[model samples]
Target chain A: MSAVLTLDHVKKVIGGKTIINGLSFSVREGEVFGFLGPNGAGKTTTIRMIVGLMDISEGDIVICGKSIKNDFTGAIKEIGAIVENPEMYKFLTGYQNLLQYARMHDGITKEKIREVIELVGLTDRIHDKVKKYSLGMRQRLGLAQCLLHDPKLLILDEPTNGLDPAGIREIRDHLRMLTRERGMSVIVSSHLLSEMELMCDRIAIIQNGELIDVQTINEFTEQATAAFAFETGSLGDAATWLKSDWNALMMEEGFSVEITREQVPVLIKKLTAEGIDLYGVKAVAKTLEDRFLEVTTK
Target chain B: MGKLIINECAKLFRRTGTWVMFAIVIIMILGIGAFLKYGEVNNPPQVNPAWEQELAMQLEADRAALEETGQNNATLRMFYEREIAVKEYQLEKDLAPETGVTLWSLMSEAQAVIGIIGVFTIIIAAGMVASEFSWGTVKLLLIRPIKRSKILLSKYLTVLLFGGLMLTVLYTVSALVGLVLFGMPEQARPYLAFADGEVVERSMFIQLIYNYLLSSIDVLMLATMAFMISAVFRNSSLAIGLSLFLMFMGGTGTMLLASKFDWAKYVLFANTNLTVYFDGVPPVEGMTLAFSIIMLLIYFVVFHLLAFFVFAKRDVAA
Candidate 1:
């Protein structure tokens, strides 16, 4: 499947300072792509450019194979976005806010307004004024608005920000359901790496306005280097023997020993043959957070 | 387009400020009407009868004085002619001319309240759209499916509609108030006169409508200025305040400037007031109704254009 969203050599500068420089990434159709970055990492800036809320200083942003700068409204027609904060009219009812957005897209019926409100689970409170709504309710309403137009691509910035655990779970499940049921592509950016690991099909890590890496969770885990851990009755003897003999043996056998858990079994068997005791063995698997920190830190 | 206009009108009506302005116009008209009538009832204009009688006696004495000095019959005829002219002048002076209707005369009963209603309706008309931005409704407005220019156009029309509604209420209440307070006068002539010699006499109701239309232009100017400022600053109070301040300055700024400078007449505000069109002659020698109108129109167009350009081109991301 072709990419639904693509940024090629995108650069944005404000007041003589570069906000995003030569950033590039693509999200495939039917993919829940999580864009992970720290605060002030230019995530919002990139999202704004994608949504046509700001003019791009350089490079092209293609939404569904259409350039946003050249074909803004046309490209935007197929993309839905909730940027930084869910800005809305405080005085209007939740339903009214959705209705206003509904009018922007052709063929959106009043019935569709009811449907989206129901989808967001805000039907009962849609008539309440937005100003009176809690932050979670507002976020849900904002999601409802983005979903109203039924765009093929959904771009959300920090969708789980300021939400209770249940609210965050609801959004996470809702987004997964949306992608699963409709086969829609979603780009969700957040600082919460664990949620992204759970929710996204693929993820891109960005740091300092640069794309550090893009990989699936499984590939990221599988590509991580295996570490061996070891335990022995005599810690000093084990270290001394390994430093001289095992280190050479493992290196010569096309393996690297880190004096971790995997070496415990080998050392025990070898030590028993040499009349020495072994106690324990262990192996370590890398976590998403560890991988994220590793990639972004560099 | 029609739906947008209707929606704007609906929003306009929903505003508490709109109701407040309407109430102010009505109360002002009624209050001014009652004050005029009460003053009229308690203090009828006192005519100077003594002066009138003295003038008449002087004319009669002049006739007698001229005849006594006549030398020939023809001379006596000339003397008598001069005496008759003197007597006619004195007789004319002795009889008091009928007094023109006062504010009380027009509104004490109900009809005069129309003029006062017209004034406040115009004031309210100026504030309608500017208040929306002041209240931060423009964000909700611009994000809708409609174009930006169309939004402003709808507001422009709504301001006029509001002016019409307020003016209607003003006219009805003033007429009702007039009928109740004072019986309808026999000569129901309109109070307005154009530059043409022809007098445009309207029924009290029609006069109210015409006067409202005349006052609406002031609101239109203010609304346009407010729209420009609202679009530029994107703040309602600033737009309303600046526009109103300019209007206030327009009324008296010229006079103050004239004391210090000879070019006061060139100021835009000094030329914006439509009252001068009704007042006999304008304060400035070259100032005319047509000139003032054209200048106001130019300002209106310029402000709207600036607003449109700024709104369309400004980076909204900030």
Candidate 2:
């Protein structure tokens, strides 16, 4: 996949404090790249810089092969974004707001507006003034406006912030469909790691303005060591036996094990006869949240 | 550019503030026109009768001089023709004072007061542009496929078009009101004068039209100033406040310096009343209408340049 957006050693400082220091990342075409970071980790700042809403103190951001500083119009031409809260003209109807945004782009038709409103599931209430809209509805409208330009890259800063479960699900589904249908790439930032895990193909985890890791979910899970746990008819015996066995294994091959529960057996006899005794055999799968905690903690 | 302008114009029409301001201008013009018409009815001045008497006396004196000379019939006819010419001149002069209170007169007064209305235009213009930022829709605005400069220009043009429309409505309606209230006289006359004693002859309708047009420049300048302030401040209220303060200070600053400082002639408000230049003898020396126009043009350029620079560079993250 071609790189739709690339930031190289980008740095930003405001009022003598560094917000993003030498941060680097690339978002590829047709990839749903999740930018996972805790609040105030400069995720919003970086996104703003990419979308040409903020100036970079140093370094470069390239969008669709155009430098943000040198070719802002060119870089922004195919980029759409919702930085932090989605802001709109409350006095204007949702459709009017969308129309205002659409006018900024060349060649957007009325059908396209209808298409976007439909995509965001706001068509029924599109003519209502935005002041009457719920936060989720406003968010959906913001998404519709961004989509109106048919941009190649979308930088959504905490796009799911403040959304209800249903609204979040709807947005996630819509985003997935958009990517699949239009081959549009998205860079989404959120404090919710689990949501990112479910929605994105790949995720970049950042802490303290530094990108700690970028990995596919499978890679993250696979690399995380699974806990080999078992239970025996005798809890004490299970603990001792497993400790000795796992300790030896650890010494020899670096494999690990732990006792989790005890169960009667047919199990001990069957496991001893087949050389596997502990009835409880469980290996913990590494969830995205687990990996996020480990990475951020580290 | 054309598309942006069209969109801006459409938005202006859609906005309720534009209509509200239009209604205010109409009310002001009609209210003032009505009051003046009522005043005219109650207190019809005495000069009109005095002017008629003066014309009659001039004609009678000419006839008496011819009789005293015992002139022949041909010479008496010559005297009669001369008397007719003097009578025509006197009648034209007599029409002058009445012309000063006609519909054109009210419109000219309205036009002069239109500078004060620039305050309203400034608020409207500032709000029109600054509300986008206060509402935080600038993000949506910039992301669209158009250049930032064009978007800013669209807003500026929209405010200007709205101001122009309001002025047109105010001027036209006020004239109609004046004509209805005070009988529409048959002949139009020039109401203003030149210091060199040269009279500018214009139809009342044309004078009213020019007054509206000329006042529009002040509106345009104020609108541009308000837009620039809105661009920088990004808040409609603050933009409105600061713009008004500056406009007020512009006049005050000019007044304070007009007597004390020779260079005060370069200040924008000091030179705003272009008619003052035609007053023949200027209150201050070395000031000309051409100079005022040039000064105002410089200010116009400066205001727009600041607006464009600040708007294009400032982050719209707010």
Candidate 3:
């Protein structure tokens, strides 16, 4: 698939300090690309640069094949973003806010406004002043605003920063639906690895202003060594034999060995040939959180 | 660009503070009118029917003094000659001498509302850009499909529009109240001025419009100053505080300096009041309307340059 956004050697230097050092990434069309990083890892900074809120020190960002430096208006017209908090005018109603945003773009009809409001499930409170709305409702209103222009790319920096679990789930599901139905690419940044794993098709991990790795969630989790636990009679004997032969370790109720999926049957046959009556063997899968910690800590 | 300006205006009108400021302006105008009416009702001034006799006496006394002094000073000679011309014209027209309040006089008095308008405009101008940063709404505004220059220009245009709106409200309210209290005059009068060693007469309506425009010069400059501060600092309180303080004290401070130093004529405050060139001499000798206009233009360009350059270049990290 073609990329909706591309960062070519993007660098950010503020006050003589390199905040983002030679970062490069591409978000493909119709995919939820997750940006995983700890606090102060240049996630918000990168998002800001992508949205043209801050200047890119030494590189260019191209949105839908238009360079931001060469054609800012042309490039930015294809993007809808909420950098940091989705701050809006609290004095105006959500509908008025949407109207104000609608004026910035051409050909946004009243029917489109109603459709976005309904899509975000804010049709009931869309007429109320934004100051009176809850944070989740504000986020929904922000989403409605981003959708008003029908942008090709949506960049949300920490979209679920202060949301409850239910709100987070709703945002995640809404983003998934948009990606699936509208075929619009989304770049979302978060520190929550579990949510990223569940929400994103692919994830990019960054640490200390450097891109550590970028891969599919399945590849990130399953590419690690597989651990298999074998529950059998004579657990101590099996543990010793497997430890010498396959470098096994003792588990709670069985002896565990680290091997590939293809070698599991061979290991099981070896254990049985040693006259160890095996009860069952199961492979232990590494969760995204575990892989995230392992990658970040390394 | 048009849509951005409209959006900015819509946001401006949506704020409660903008409406409150408008109400304050209207109430202040009404309050001034009522106070003047009350004063006139409670303490009526005695008008002398034989004011011609009084004028003859004063003119003779001024002539005797000029003779006694030998009319050595040019300024004093000009002053006496202008006073004599005014008194002679009033006696010739058989007009009452400063008798009762007229609609024109009330409208002239209502010009004091310009100062109040200046305060309100300064408040709006100071908060125009800074409040966006404080409210965190700048992010939403800058992420739009338009350029930053268009965004900032649209905001500044909206501020000027609000100032114009307030000025219109002040003039309309004052005119309406004056009409109700002091009926319209049967004839339009001419304003007399001492120019080129003789008395000159000009149309009063033209003079009134000129007065309004001239009086608004200081206000426009100060509002622009406040706007520049708001854009550069992005702190509404600082912009308002500094601009308001300068608006109130700038003229007085420049006057004090003008008395002591000739270089004070070059200062912004000394050149802001373009009205002085019309009716009276500038605070400093040798200062003319063209010079002040040039000075104002320089400051105007400089302030806008700084505002636009800083707003466009500075990173919106917050």
Name the best candidate (by DockQ).
3
**C-alpha root-mean-square deviation, candidate 3:** 3.4
TM-score of each: 0.75, 0.82, 0.90
Name the TM-score of chain A in model 3.
Answer: 0.87
Candidate 2, residues B1-318, lDDT tens digits: the string is 877887677666676866776777777887788778777777774555466776677777766776766355443444355445545554666553452357666766676557656877888788866777776767666765566778888788777776677777777787787777776766655544322333444556766676577656656776787888888777788778877886768767777788798887777677766654432233346676688789888999998898888888876657
Q: Model 1: runs farther than 4 Å from truth? A: A225-286, B3-187, B198-200, B258-263
Candidate 1 or 3, higher DockQ?
Answer: 3
Q: Write the per-residue lDDT of candidate 3 for residues A1-298, one digit (tens) a residue.
A: 9999999999999999999998998999999999998889989888888888889999889999998878888998899888878898988999999999999888999999999999999988888999999998888888898999889999888888788999999999999998999999999998887888888989888888889998998888877887788887766456666678889887777777889999988987777777877889888877787788889998
Candidate 2, position B129, lDDT: 67
lDDT of 3 by residue, B113-167 (tens): 8898899889989988998999998998888878888888998888889888887
Model 1 lDDT tens row, A1-298: 8898999999998888988899988988888998988888888888878877667889999988789878766788788777766766666678866765665567888888888889999988989988899999999998887888788899888999999999999998998889889978999999888888788989887878888888897887666655554444544354567678766223322233545455556656776776544454446566778777777776
Give the chain A TM-score for each candidate. 0.84, 0.85, 0.87
Can you tell me which runs of candidate 3 are displaced by over 4 Å? A226-284, B53-88, B186-190, B193-206
Fnat per model, in the order given? 0.20, 0.59, 0.86
DockQ metric, candidate 3: 0.79
DockQ of each: 0.23, 0.44, 0.79
Instruction: Identify the superior model by TM-score, candidate 1 or candidate 3.
Output: 3
> lDDT values of the candidates?
0.68, 0.74, 0.86
